[model samples]
Target: MVSAVPECGGPGDLPAPRIVTDLAHGGRWTSLTAGGREWLWHRDEPRRAGVGPGDPFADAGGLEECVPTVRGTPDHGDAWSRPWRRAGEEESVDCPDFRLTRRVSAGAGRTVVDYRLTAAPGYRFLWAAHALLEVSGRARAVMTGG
Candidate 1:
């Protein structure tokens, strides 16, 4: 499970479409089946401290430093290398100010993701959603929001 179209290839050149629901390697969300039950968390692993190989749609922080000369400007900003713009199931990544969109949909048991962030106003930024769900043996998680 690995749908590829993110761009600026590197992770083994990309494109591995078996097609159930796959988008691992940088824009990770590996698999999801819904009510029938097939939610196995993915891992090919390597790339530690900076985080796993499976990057469940990672986004570090935003608007970090760099305005003095402003060349590439990436310490932990710009949504991890930035190259996503697939329309249909929806996948977007842009950065002049901010525009990160991810949309995944499923039914039955539920696998719905609609993460969006569109900033470009006064530009005070701080975004966080580094998803890594690998629960096998003992699993218990309950999180609300603020």
Candidate 2:
């Protein structure tokens, strides 16, 4: 089963909100749940051991971060294929030219991830959140605050 926050909460034993991540393997979020419904797509098969620059696509699903050019020489950049250094709620990876960091926080019914990229002046890079969502046929989106 995907790793998640313990179902038991402080003192009351109430079901706690849950989110899952695999930090050693690309530092990607493997699952996200709210209202007892899963919101991310995941592969049913065993995930590969690791990915590397120029390696074939790791279609292992969930949310992955692509960095420093998504469709370039190294394929899906450098971050998604390597391990990250974790400090509290934040994790960071050092690329050849830049450092990418992400902080995740959860509150109420929402989970927030904040990203920061650092590099020398004049350095340029690209980043994207490659999140795959699980949507059922009857699912509908609610939009607010346009």
Report lDDT (CA) for all predictions: 0.43, 0.73
lDDT of 1 by residue, 23-110 (tens): 2222434443332343444544444124431233233221111211122334434555434456777776666677777775543323
Residue lDDT tens for model 2, 51-78: 6555665878888888887888577777
Clashes of each: 0, 0
List TM-score per model, in order: 0.25, 0.79
lDDT of 1 at 117: 71
Q: What is the overall TM-score of model 2 with all chains considered together?
A: 0.79
